[model samples]
Target: MSDADLPFTAALYASTRTEELAPLPWPEEAKRMFLAQQHAAQHAHYQQHYRGMEAWIVEHGGAAIGRLYLHDMPGEIRIVDISLIPEARGQGIGAALLHDLFAQARLRERRVTIHVEKNNPARTLYARLGFTILDDDRGAYDLWEWRAAA
Candidate 1:
């Protein structure tokens, strides 16, 4: 993602967390402010930990729709994060993207991994795509991995 995509990327981040934030009783402006701060922090953390990671802007109909962050390591391709705007979700865009990533991973014989919230709905899709829980700390997130069969 480029500097031009920052606003849309922030909005996509907020959309992903909207359901969790809905019951917080914060005013809309306050929520937006918090989301912006959180997005900045997360972005910084990812950049610090996964320097040179690949970032992609998911587009549909010539408009930006989402963001995909990836880190390709020697043995695994880590999905740092993926978020879509509310209007663009549940339309198979995410699945298609994952399938494409899986194809690439298969070609390189590398495992694909992601850390997802325990209750995130996308976990179901990852399961359907053959990802298995590689580590679960019983915390907010679990590490999942997928490998193409021999």
Candidate 2:
């Protein structure tokens, strides 16, 4: 993603965390500021971990909608992060993108892996997409992997 995409990216990040922060007693501005800082830290962490990762902006109707960060490692394609605006979710966009990734992995004979938060709703979708848990990080996050059917 380019510098021009920062605002949209931050908005998407905030959307993902809105529900978790909603019940908190913080003011809206404070919550937004915290999310901005968290988003910056997350961006830095991804850059550090996936040095040569591929970045793609998910678009719909010619407008930017989300971001998909991927790393094509030696034996696996790691989905570093995937975020969609709240309005664009639940419409099968994410599933379709993931299915495309799965197809690509199959062609290359590589596993597709992702880590999802323990309580993230997307974990159910990943499981439905045939990803099996490879590691459970003590209830924080689960590492999931999907391999091409033999």
Candidate 3:
């Protein structure tokens, strides 16, 4: 995403963050403050750590719905992050994006990898899409990988 896209992309990020915070018992204002701070920190972390990260603002029918961050290297395409607003959830968007990523991986002959929290519902989708756990030693998150059949 470009500098100009930051404002809208951040809004998209905030929507996803709101969903994440939904289960907490905190007040609305507290959630708002926490999300704002967390977004800034996460953005900075991505910028500083992944110099060549490819960030995309996922859009549907002219409206921004989510964000995708990827890090492409020699033999792997790492999905640093992918998040959608609550309204966009369960709408097949994430699966479509994964299929597109898989196509890219097939063309490039590289494996696709992503880290998903162990209890995250999306882990089921990843598994259904043929991503197998590569590592689960990192506590909450498991590293998953998918490669085309030879």
Candidate 4:
């Protein structure tokens, strides 16, 4: 569907297949590809688990500005990662993106869960959205979850 069809004021979400993100527009950390390649065997591992994947792209005024990745599960949808370009940070764009995400999840009666890097500022934003830290390991990071308070 076209961005114009999205009811959200700022962003549109398009759910798609995992293979579709093979050549993503996202920036990768240095050596990230090499590391992923080194564990190529694990590629199949992930692909098998998340057989269905969807990439969320945030656009504004016809310009692509952000992205997020997710996969549907038997009882939930997992938000793997999300990022917005530096220029768009702190513009209420992320919250709007997440608000739409939660609305979609709640409509389906599924909880929203995500992993947050300890140093990432988005954790603060997620907290404001009612996500609570579920687990933490100093070096690895933490898990946060938000359930509809029924």
TM-scores of all candidate predictions against the true structure: 0.96, 0.97, 0.90, 0.67
For residue 64, model 2's alpha carbon misses the true position, in angstroms, by: 1.1
Clashes of each: 0, 0, 0, 0
Candidate 4 off by > 4 Å: 1-49
Candidate 2 lDDT score relative to the true structure: 0.92
Model 3, poorest ten-residue lDDT window? Answer: 10-19
Report the C-alpha lDDT of model 4 over 1-150, residue by residue, as the tens digit.
234423321221222112234477655543344344433443345457666667556678997776666877766778865766666879999898888889999899998888777866678888999999888864667988888889
Which digits, one per residue and each the tens of the lDDT, describe model 1 over residues 1-150?
887888888888888889899999899999999999998998889989999999999999999988999998999999999888888888999999999999999899899999999879988889998999999985899999999999
For 1-150, candidate 2 gives per-residue lDDT tens digits of: 887888889889999999899999999999999999999998899889899999899999999999999999999999999978888898999999999998899999999999889879988789898999999975788899999999
TM-score of 4: 0.67
lDDT of each: 0.92, 0.92, 0.88, 0.66
Candidate numbers, best TM-score first, in rank order:
2, 1, 3, 4
lDDT (Cα) of model 4: 0.66
Error of 1 at 99 (Å): 0.8
Q: Residue-wise lDDT of candidate 3 within 1-150, one digit each (tens)?
A: 788877766666678656578899999888878777777788899999888999998999988888899999879999999988788999899999999999999999999999888878888899999999999998989999999989
Clashing pairs in 2: none
Clashing pairs in 4: none
Task: Report the C-alpha displacement of residue 19, candidate 2, in angstroms.
Answer: 0.6
